[model samples]
Target: MPILQWLTRDEDTRAVRSVPYRLLQEESALSCGDPDAANMLIHGDNLDALKALLPFYAGRVKCIYIDPPYNTRSAFEHYDDNLEHSKWLAMMWPRLELLRDLLAEDGSIWVSIDDNEVHYLKVIMDEVFGRKNFTSTIVWQKRIGPDSRAILGAAHDYIVVYSKNLEAFKATANKIPLREDQIAEFQNPDNDPRGPWTSSSNFSAQGFRKNQMYKIVTPGGAEYYPPEGRCWVTIESEYFRLLKEGRMWFGRDGRGMPRKKTYLKEREGQATWSWWSNSEVGHTQESKKEIIALFGASNTFDTPKPERLIQRILHIATNPGELVLDSFLGSGTTAAVAHKMGRHYIGIEMGDHAVTHCAPRLQKVIEGEQGGISKSVNWQGGGGFRFYRLGPPVFDEDGHVREDIRFPTLAAHVWFSETNAPWKGKGKSPFLGHHDGKGYALLYNGILGDRRPDGGNVLTRSTLQIIREAAAKKAPTFDGPLTIYGEQSRLGPTTLARENITFKQTPYDVRARR
Candidate 1:
């Protein structure tokens, strides 16, 4: 691991600068009143919201499901749809950092991606989250049938599951909507109070050596025996005990071979495995049909996930009231299913399209005005969410200074991304006038403007004015690094060195991070 150091007293030591990064909307705190509120819709750069969530939800989330931009090189119009391979890795690196932190000790994150970045994502996840934390890369049959024109049908998508720590988290087993064939297996042969029952094999393949050679009497005096070279898993003593206890069953005539009865009411549902095919959930056809049934066939977005598909994932990955977060909420399908299932959810979408598309769809589900799974599915819908968006980015923007930006936005940007903790004062800015040993820091868009709303611009004025003012009391230097943003030379070389602080700025080109 590389070291990110800052606050070096001497020029010899590197400053600590490696802090967790996430996108959060810079805004006044919006109140939704359900502190244990199960639902949230965060609108901003995901990098920030994810960072903000770390403080409260670190190791607290139960399930995380994200369907990020697939890197298909196809534009979504709303999201800046492409990042070069390395850039994509860099962009995802920080988000993964925060995701790992916010996950509950026993929680898991499921990422949905296609062929483009799946392999690379797996490797990076292994590097950052640890390969030991890997659960499985479930191959979902994304399409039900054949479209034979192509050399091979690209009919599947992969859902990669990862845990915070290999031994810490596990996905809760989910119940599948009982199918007719499964339901039919249970019969009320004796019309027991349990409703229905299914028979199970009671014979074991080990341990029952004495019973291994025992004979079974049939209804017509025929003696049936264990096959050659095989032994019962249990002893003859236990078989007799089971038979006496009525756990074992012979023919209705009470003279046939023995079997075990599995009462339907007593059995937990079948356990789910990793394989998921599109037919049970839905493929493109089923996905589109669902959209049409709800919003009409004409409704379309560059990309939309099927609700049934989301339900399938939620079904296997979470339980009631568990937190389910979707950083790439697209159309809010995860929230929709989670809400219907009585789970708490938090969704983060960066597109302006959220207000028009994501919000409305979620509202319908909450108000019970929408049908979630339109086919033979039944969803009991009820729950709510509060919506939020990022305020303006920083204290400065464009060619000239904008006086309207608040001090808080600047402070949050500094401390959250800074290498140091125990930052003094609030708001998001790095500057709070003259103080003691530590203060705030801010550098953005090639502009490093650090000054409080009150006219204390410390860099140009005092370096140790406070330390001398109160001889008995110690005050933190209360100024920040005179970091340079944009081109270092734009602010003049002599001015840059006088501040004696580190300078950093974002590269403007969309391609730079890669």
Candidate 2:
């Protein structure tokens, strides 16, 4: 596949790998409602927050929705929304990488963007998510009126959808419910025993099969043949069967072209299409009013999306209790919608509004305030979310691992680095976890009660023996090679080779510089 290359392509390509892992510090005092709820509202730079979430959430999220900065050069009260082209691409590439990792194999991601960067974003996403996974570019009408500044008014934006695996997503995808007007189209005109019905064409233009060109006789004894270049959609035998069962329809005169009577009882809903109108979903004005109602102010956020829009997305992408995430929390519309819809959510934002705008709005949701999508989703409200702040960087300016880092945190990092999988173990011992038929172990934070950097943190004969015994107790049948990451290794190459051990020095070997 051809790639989208920009000035900072090389630098941005390596950016996600170079992002230093950070710790999440929960602020229990600011958290509201129940503590057992799995929802989270994280206040920090989103890039770092995404990295912090990987250890526990990778491959667990069912849906992700993000409304990133459009790079429109328009200044807002909270977001800059302005950056050089290359700079914007650099900022976005790494975040996309982390989001892709957090997505489950059967999950999908929806991104909202406008014309200024939509084309570029598509090319970049095609590279990140495989081109085969590209789903559709939905045109969302964001305005009821037109813009007078340009020769042609721009009234719509787009939401691009991509699935982690196209085949897997197809198995679970649902259809959109029929609109009132669509339901009106089906009526019981002939008073048939089968309820309301609609007519569908019964002819094909290809005329590929000779048996599909047979004649038809109407109830009034009128004869008919296939049109000039068309053939019947079914074979003669099947057409006779449908005719005998009263499933075939002719015009009111009883001599018109044959049609199939589609009954309403067999219909679940309509398949989704690419066009979404403001009248059906929402518009910019409605979105602004929603933000005002939640925050009790105007201009708090210039580009907040409407909760109904997110609700529509959640309706198709998620189910009750599934994990949903939004990295650009903005006015917190995505989280609010997810909560009301009964989905667990994790929202990340950098601005002060994460506290001032996002958290307080959720508190109202827990209190059963009917606003935005509450009435739509029938949310009487009873759930909670914890609030957190980003802690110090995992690595210092001098490229040394922070001394205050805990064993579990370091273990999560080492497991991710060596196996490229989220660390799900509790780090009960030096043995972190096993993946791809290999056992990974980490020696940090003096798990052996020796605090010296080169003492308990080093891989020596005794450390190896301890890990072997622990591995036997936990993963008894495991015979894979052991890869250990530590402060240092005292054992020589001969011993390492003979024991099937691979050692990586800590700090420099694991720290991410960017």
User: Each prediction's TM-score against the native?
Assistant: 0.66, 0.85
Residue-wise lDDT of candidate 1 within 1-514, one digit each (tens)? 3332223222211111133233344222432333345478888778777765653455667788988888777776666768767666666666776787678777888998889989878887886678888988888787767679878878888889998765655445456666678889878765555577776664545433664667666435656566555665456677677666556666577666567777766666666567777766666666666556656656656556677778877776677778888898876778777877778888888887466666777767755645647223455344557777755433223322233433443343344334223224443233332324433333332123333321232322232232123322323333444432222223345655664544454322101110
Model 2: per-residue Cα lDDT over 1-514, one tens digit each: 8898899899899988767677899999879898889899999999999988886788888999999999999897898988887888999899999999999998999999999999989999999999999988999999888887878888998999999998888787777778889899998877889999998966555655788888888876688888777787889999889888988888778877788888888888778788998877888999988877877775468877877788888888888899999999998899999988899999999999998989999999999978787786788979999999999887787666777788888788777767667777874689886898999888877887685744678888888888898888779999888898888898999999898888987766776523
lDDT of each: 0.60, 0.86
Q: Check candidate 2 and list the clashing pairs.
A: none
- Model 1 is weakest, by summed lDDT over 10 consecutive residues, at 505-514
Please give the clash total of every predicted structure, in order.
38, 0
Worst 10 residues of 2 by lDDT: 201-210
For model 1, give the RMSD to the true fold: 11.4
* Candidate 2 lDDT score relative to the true structure: 0.86
Which regions in candidate 2 have their CA more than 4 angstroms from the true location?
A: 1-5, 148-151, 189-195, 203-205, 218-220, 237-247, 250-256, 396-403, 426-432, 441-514
In model 1, where do residues sit more than 4 Å from their true spots? 1-38, 77-84, 165-172, 175-177, 190-195, 206-229, 251-257, 293-298, 374-382, 392-514
